[model samples]
Target: MLIATHSGKFHADDVWAVAVLDILFPGSQLIRTRDAARLAEADFAVDVGGVWDAAAGRFDHHQKGFDGARQNGVVYASAGLVWKEYGGRCVAQLAHECCGQELPPQRAQEIAWAIDSDLVQYLDMADTGSAKNAPGGYGLSAVVSGFNPTWIDEQMAGSVEAAEEFRLNQFRRAMGFIREIIINAVKYRVGALLALDQVRQAERLEGGSVLFLGNAALPWSSVVRNEMPEVLFVVSYSMNENRHMIHTVPVAADSFKARKDLPKAWAGLRGGELAAVTGVEDAIFCHNNVFIAAAVSYEGIMRLARLALAEPDPRGA
Candidate 1:
């Protein structure tokens, strides 16, 4: 199998599209060219064939009269065009390889949609001039495009062949970077889906006001905030630090205001000072914002949680 894309310069869209194909069709040869004969002979033509037929493995969006857009109106670039067709399979394969789980077809499509909404669409937006690069130029699209050779570097190469060779090397580097992004995206979504049941079954304490999770690494915020409405705070064991942590449940996603905040008296206190305030001898520290606190033992954390629960919200009775 041969994968062919345009030569000269590369963008995140082309790199991402090619990377997906390369991953799905392993052992495929890659060539950088615009020659129609060469592109015609390739197994897949990406970003340069001036076509958008997925069944034929032609995934270019530069053709005339192309008006492909998502339901939300984001225009399709080569990346989006290819991803719309192959993303589910890519996600499934990555989940099996990187996460050791074979996702169902429906589940794989769900994760693919998430990646499209969160990451792929932005690459398309930037590629099509529909949106600006993320502020501070830290966006993935900008980062990937940075891999392209600069004019000075091309001049330094001193010949078309040397410059094209250098560009191809950089293109491969960019593809490697994009490939990692895809794997991580798959791993994260898969892990979150797997953790949902654990979050749902986490032990409830203090009359269900406090939730306890054995593993702090589990993603419980969305579950706790949305599903477990009665849960005001969560206590979990931090394996990394070998400590116990209590966290205030936020009122909503990404909101700073938690459903309940720790007592004002405990704010910013640490070590013996926090212990004195809470009377939990092993109490470690409380954030000044009172959204989080830590203790050396489960008993200490539970005690702090009970005290905070009994304490009135300073804003009102």
Candidate 2:
């Protein structure tokens, strides 16, 4: 996944965020820009706009007054503006103000918090009546909601053992699909895109064996769900003129499937019922089209199946 950091002007926070992204995804490219044209092609662009407000001596989105007193007028405002303007499809704001420290790990956690916070606002804004109950209009509500302070604390409070187990499970499920389709016995060239540096393993499946049997965590909005046995898959997409398409896949399951056999299973999963059975409850799929800024929840795995089918067979590549 490509990550682009945009700012109307630079700030310490933007520098820190870029450093964190670099540490997390060494292969991912990072770009700094104020011009809308440069950001048009990014797969995922983070707006550090607010950081420039102090520098520009302008009012930030949060209406925080800028004083030219602190080292020559630097502010944090343009990131949001650029995000609002040319962010196009895959855009997320990296609200770094809440996180006090600039350490890599801390910054990464802050990034997660920002993303989750933004997602909540996005969901709220999309829902009807949300604006009426909200303190301000929809736009203001979104900004306020996106500024989550306790997210990192909450996540950190969770059991480390539990979190590791959950992450491992999700990684296994992802590997299952990858092995089955991309690294099948057919020997297709397979590539992987993992953000948040969450992938723990990408092992090759020896046979069609269902070796491991245990519950795993599935990626939801902010937290990962520990559902048993059956896997839940999520597929999110955004299209760009230059990049063509960018997709996010999150999975949770108990075992692995062979590479060659995934096609039939994937096909069968399309539009299937997602209701939980004995071991799993609240099984569902959430598909978000970032290009259109829309999201939908599916009853079953059909959305993933459809996405898989829609994807060109990389074997041909």
TM-score (all chains, Cα) for each model: 0.95, 0.20
Tens digits of per-residue lDDT for model 2, 1-317: 45555432233222323333333345666554445565556544544233333223221233245331212222223232322222221111122222222334443444343432343223222322323224554443233333322446337749755444443343333323322321121111011112212322211111311111111221221222232122222233223211111122223233232121222222212122322211112323222321111113222223333434344544552
Off by over 4 Å in 2: 1-52, 55-215, 218-317
Model 1 worst lDDT window (10 residues): 132-141
Candidate lDDT values, in order: 0.93, 0.30
After TM-score superposition, the amount by which residue 314's alpha carbon in candidate 1 deviates from its true location, in angstroms, is: 3.1
On the 0 to 100 scale, the lDDT of residue 52 in model 2 is 31
* Most accurate candidate by TM-score: 1
lDDT of 2: 0.30
Clashing pairs in 1: none
When superposed on Cα atoms, how far off is each prediction in RMSD? 1.5, 20.8
